[model samples]
Target: MKILLTAINSKFVHSNLAVRYLKAFTKDMDYDCKIREFSINDREEKILEEIIKESPNVVAFSTYIWNIEMIKRLSNLIKLVDENIEILYGGPEVSYDSQNILRELNGDYIIEGEGEKTYREFVEYKLQERSLEDIRGLYYKKDNNIFFNGKRPLMNMNEVVFPYEEDENLDNKIVYYESSRGCPFNCSYCLSSTIHGVRFLDIERVKKELSYFIKKEVRLVKFVDRTFNCNHKFTMAIWEFLINQDTKTQFHFEISADLLKDAELELLRKAPKDRFQFEVGVQTTNDEVLNRINRFVNFSDIKEKVDELLKLRNIKQHLDLIAGLPGEDYNSFKRSFNDVYSIKPEEIQLGFLKLLRGASIREEAVAYGMKFSPYPPYEILKTKDLSYEELLKLKKVEEMVDKYYNSQKFNNIINYLVKQFDNPFDFYYELGKYFDKKGYFNRNIGNSEYYKVFLDFNMEILKGDKDILNELLRFDYLNFNKKRGIPDFIGRSIKRGEEEEIKNMLRHKYSFKEYYLESFEIDIQTFLKDSIIIKKKDYYLFGYGGDIIHITEEIKEY
Candidate 1:
């Protein structure tokens, strides 16, 4: 019997660790098993064609919130082509409501919860013509009645197979590895909280797996652990191992900042720059909101740890906040935004709350007056504290944040604006309001247009000093890209002869041998327009990629 395990990923770069794990665990089973993966962006017809070509007797799909609708459609199409084809569904999206999924979607079977051992057993039962009633975690339809054999016990971590050994071509794609399963904290909104306890693989096993990835120099190995730093000793051991390896492979982890011990922080500080990235979920700053969601975090301690982390300037920190939640109104959310923004993380992920199935928050939605989209993500439209109108406003704010703040294109400009404005939220709110009023948010806007819009906002709305804004914009623009051509709105150009003179001076000052002149290479006209020429006591030369070199006056010791 042929069995095909598949997964529809959110992106092409994301490899489905779940499907790979399932495939690896069932390798030795008495059946033909193959793993196929496709992205949500892929056309349905193309995906259907590929699946039909496989012509497997059984097709099991790993489902998630992002690709459930697509998988359902694909499953229906597969059944239409061949009625004998058995369709099975698994993963978190269908794990909780297998019965409903089987009834509504007409799926042939679902292996709920931990599927490694259960799937092998089910496949063996089917191949050997054995009774299906004995298989645990198997929800199958027999004689027009659905039978749910109770959930299987969680498998030991050591028994779980290593998925990557068989897969080739690991370069560029994100390699997701899990050292542990489940979470320690019972955050009401999170699906990870559904699993009661945490289980870990042996440290030696984890180290061996990590060594392979490090040796291969994979682009990124993002830990799929619910809370990576839940166990301080385990986390430190892994961190120390990675640090010692000093490989090009960068590791990413979702960790609780507040839980970081002093020694752990010190160890992290010692690690190489840009070698690790930590995604800290500070969902909301309001203690009341946090408490309502059963998310216990010491905001002050988290801030303290994050501040300490920032001082090192090595590890990339991505802080997150959820917009609509119980007890968090528009004003309260603004405070949360400003509070997190103040810490100045590498990226501030402004996300909306999704009422996921089996999550405690979804059950309490009615009590909180939560109205959500009746779709896959089930994102909140409104709640008791925040209205639909207010949520829409936040949506606009999210757009602005994504375009400017999160893009890291306007780094210096954002820093300057925050200092000029009362708070970061006001800056973003005003910018979002301006974008909405001008109808900029309705369609696609390019990077150049974004710069123009910011300039317009600064000049027209804020009525800031033109010279200072221009200087700040110049600094911000050059930090990211090479000097190609300066926009007319920002500055004016110099004469051809004068431009030639400045270029010659720059060339003489920064020899091709001493400085990396290739990156600093610019046409005379482009250099004249883009370079900021400022008079500070004496005439100084400033190129886009280099520091100001004293041209007229001798350099003085500080």
Candidate 2:
């Protein structure tokens, strides 16, 4: 049988690890199996054309909340093109409601839970044209009736095959791997809570698989483990192995900050800069709200550990906050935002709660007066404690935070401007409101235009010094931008004559070759053309001469 496994990713940079696992596990089977990937952004007609060219007898799709709707449309289209082609659905999106989904969509089968073993067996039955009644974890339609083969028991982690093989090319793509399955905590809003216990792959097997990635020098490998640090020894072994390797591949993990102990901190401190990124889910600071969602977290402990991690100055910390929870009102969520923002991690993700399928929170949503969209992603519209209008307002705040804080382009200006408000949340909220009033949300704002818009907003609201703000804004602009021309709002301080005189003085102090090689690491002509100087308390020099920026200061009289 000709088999085609398809994955429609949310973005081009993402890979579907589930499909890869299915392919690897069924590698030894006697069938022609191939993989095809497309992003959700791809046109429906274009995707339909490509799948038709493949001409496979069976097409299996790996579904997720972000792409399930697209998959549904494509599946029906594929059937229209050739009704003989079989449609199969798998992954978290269809796993929970398998039988109903098979009946609703134009799919012949659905694989629930862990798919590797079950998929292999199902394929064997199909290749032999035998009974699929014995295949567990499979939902199939026969004689116009949908039949589920019952739930499959979890398989040993060691039995799973490595997703990435030697022949695959992973350049410019994020490789997703899981060292373990199931989460230790029962956060009711998350799908991970549906599973009971944690299961880990053998440590040696994990090391061997990771070694392959390191040898290939993959740019990024993201661990999908819900709480990576739940088992201290297992986590440390992988970290230590990566730290000792002589490769530049970066690893990302989602870990719980409150679970960090001294030993873990000591090991993380040794991690190389830019080598690791952490996602810590501090959903809310209110202990009562956490309890309502069956999430047990100590805000104080999380803050303390986060501070220690910040002190390490190596790993990039991305903290998260969920807005619409059972007991969190609009005002209460603002407090939670302020509490998390005060920690000042590298990034803050302001997310609304998602009422996902199979999560306990979805079942309890109506009890708390939670109203969510009845579709894929099922984002919360409001709860008993929050109104739809209030949630919409927070959406604006989320936009501003993403543009200013998370982008890190307006770092200097944001750091200075946020202090002027009562708290960080107020700062972002006011900025968002200003942007909305100016109708900036409707227009396409360019990268350079952000500085001007922010400047106007600051002056209008804070009535602060334009000169000081200009200097900081210019400093931020020069650090990120390479173009020599400054925005009209951020006019240069020094006259052309003084700037030339300073460049001449530098030439006399050090030869152009030596200075460019040691400091800027670019041609002297490019350095002279691109570099800009802003007069703060001192002459702060900034240049984006290479892949990295080098900022220097000249205190001497020019």
Candidate 3:
């Protein structure tokens, strides 16, 4: 059998790892696998023509909320060209309402839960000319009838193949794998329910996967698991293995700080700094808001664990908060913000509550009198508890988070001066509010305008607070928006710091080859030396098309 695994990613930058998993799962199976990825950049007609030409025995689509509508359109178009081609849809987006999705997408077969065994079963049945509706993990629509054998008892992951063990060298690719599935916490506006429940993949198998990347010299491995810290034993085992290996390859995991045990913290502390990054969804600290959304939070413990981790100075900890959530009015949101802000994470990702499809909260949104956009994301416009005007105010605050908080360019300045207020949210909120009134922060700026705004904003931040002026001088260029000549040039090695911001300013002004000579590392000496000019010396520079050096920050101050 021939299979076409297509993934239409939500964005250009993100690679579609599902197809890689499909290819790995079907490696030994009797089939010809062709992996094709499409994005907003790809021409639609060209992709459609290719699909029409290569009418394979099976067509699999990995679904997500962002690409569902597009997937439906593509599936319809594919059916128009070849109706007999077997279409199967899986992934979180369709895992919840398999029957409806099967009918709607005109899919002959749908795999719920893990795709390895279920997808293999799909191919085997088709190859042997057997009825697929009887497959344990499959939901199928045939003879104008829908059949579901219910979900397969989630795969014994040990029996499964490694997600990237095939003919292709994945060293160049930013590989993603899950040590576990399902989230333990059931935050109301979350898709944890849709995934059914948590089942950890084999740790040894996960290590083997990591081992491959180590041997292959892949620089980064991003764990797609939700709440990586949920399973203490599993988390420890994986972290212990990678730490012991001492490979240059780094691993990124999203964890729940509240659930992180002391032992887990110790294990994490042992890992090489900058090699591991954790994103904790500290949605809100307001107890009422948390309870309204069915979230169980140990605020005190969460604070201590996060702060301790921040003190580690090795790992990058990104803490998150949601602006629009149930029981969170303007004042309540500010309290939540300030509470989270007090911890002072390396990065604060200000996000809005996206009342996603198949989420528990969306079901009871009416009870909360929530007015939300009727879309895949279904973001809350406002709830009875929170007015629309206040939500709009929160939007401005979110903009501030993106610019100063999340972008992290203003970290030095923020840390230096934002100390007078007890509530950090009030401090940030007031800052964002002040900027909007000044007409300094605009959505229309491009290149030169961007720096003008950045510098101007930083200068304003310094005038009222002189303590932050020196902090502003230690700029990391990478924190600003940047585009390079080569996509995936540095991949995960690049951090949003001065190096990147400097690189961006150069590339936008010149070209890559113009500044790039030898490979460069951004150190303090190089940063200050590069501040002056050096010609005739051919060496790698820090920024794109610039000279290279790595000097510590203290030297510049001295």
Question: TM-score, each model?
Answer: 0.91, 0.94, 0.78
Model 1 reaches what TM-score against the true structure?
A: 0.91
lDDT of 1 by residue, 29-78 (tens): 77888889899999999999999899899999998999999998998899
lDDT of 2 at 310: 94
Where does model 1 exceed 4 Å of error?
490-558
Candidate lDDT scores, in order, read 0.81, 0.84, 0.69
Cα deviation at 558, candidate 2, in Å, is 7.7
Tens-digit lDDT string for candidate 3 (1-558): 788998887655456777777777777777788887777557778878877677687788888877777778788888877888878888878887778778777667777767777777777787884566657878887679889987787666556556665355664566677777788777778777555568877777778778877887777688888888877788888888988886788788888887878897777777787889888888888877777787777667688888889877889888888877877777877877777777767777778778776788877788878888866766778888788888877777777777767666555445534554565665666666766877767655544343344445545653553222322322333333343432232233334575455555455444555443222222323333443222221222445423333333322433
lDDT of 2 by residue, 113-195 (tens): 89998899888987985479989999999999999878999988888899887979899999999999999999999989889
Best by TM-score: 2
lDDT of 1 at 255: 93
Q: Is candidate 1 or candidate 3 better by TM-score?
A: 1
Q: Candidate 3: deviation at residue 154, Å?
A: 2.0
With a 3 Å backbone cut-off (N, CA, C), the pairs that clash in candidate 2 are none
